[model samples]
Target: MKNRKHIVICEDAKTRITINRKWCKGCEICVEFCPQKTLLMEGDKAVVRDIASCNRCMLCELRCPDFAIEVSEGTGR
Candidate 1:
């Protein structure tokens, strides 16, 4: 199967969260590390649960061992 990617733009449009379903191994590291509970597990993939609550902390991206999650700044402004 092709690698599926999920992207979420924060409410302020200042932060972007990307989740690579193919690279993810269903490990809850990102979900558990998210301080704002911004990430959740959907079946076996990590998904953005609350973009409004995201504070651009990047904990989920940093804690992901598989490098499946990425938190980026800017909205191409």
Candidate 2:
């Protein structure tokens, strides 16, 4: 008989998610507010293509005046 031991570091998967394209006004406020620099301007709107880089800070969601963004946790994608 043998016992195997393994160690792993688990990180929180909760992340900032969802972007209401129609609501977005292309103000770029969210782009500037992201401390992690997770947002980018795509065409006339801000696009959050890099979901993995997001730390769920909610800066984008909070800064959006048009209610264009929504940052939340869990697997609601």
Candidate 3:
């Protein structure tokens, strides 16, 4: 009899984030709030520079006072 190891892994799939420049104030709130440092300041706006490492924390989108950032769930971006 062979013993099988049970592995329970939470699917930490990377998701894509979209930024709406119109709503962005270039305050870099999301860039600062992201746990993964997924957002970066480009010129006067924030951009999703590290989409692969995004943990879907939603911190960026939620913390944005101007509602500039949007994120997609469950799919690999």
Candidate 4:
């Protein structure tokens, strides 16, 4: 998952989560901390499982030790 990033925009485009695989070490912290269960571990990286289920709480981003996850407003750019 080196130098890889995945972005997902919710239905309303009000929330966007950016996962920076370069910074992520596959610790699974984000997956465990997400209140919405919006993330899942896929091998050595975290992938968005259900974008609509995400509540934009930013829990995953906040819990990521490597600062690899970010939740932003608007659509993914």
2 against 4, candidate with superior TM-score: 4
lDDT of 3 by residue, 1-77 (tens): 14322211122255657677666788988888888987789888887676778888888878888876777664541
How big is the positional error of residue 32 in model 1, measured in Å on the Cα after superposition? Answer: 1.0
In model 1, where do residues sit more than 4 Å from their true spots?
Answer: 1-12, 74-77
Using TM-score as the measure, the top candidate is: 1
RMSD per model, one decimal: 3.2, 13.4, 14.0, 3.7
Instruction: Encode model 1's per-residue lDDT on 2-76: one tens digit a residue.
Output: 423353333336767777667889889888888899888989988888776888887787778998788877474
Report the Cα lDDT for candidate 3. Answer: 0.70
Residue range with the least summed lDDT across 10 consecutive positions in model 1: 3-12
Q: How well does each candidate superpose onto the true structure, as a TM-score? A: 0.79, 0.74, 0.74, 0.78
Please state the error at residue 43 of candidate 1 in Å.
Answer: 0.3
User: Pairing residues by index, what is the TM-score of model 2?
Assistant: 0.74
Say what the RMSD of model 4 is: 3.7
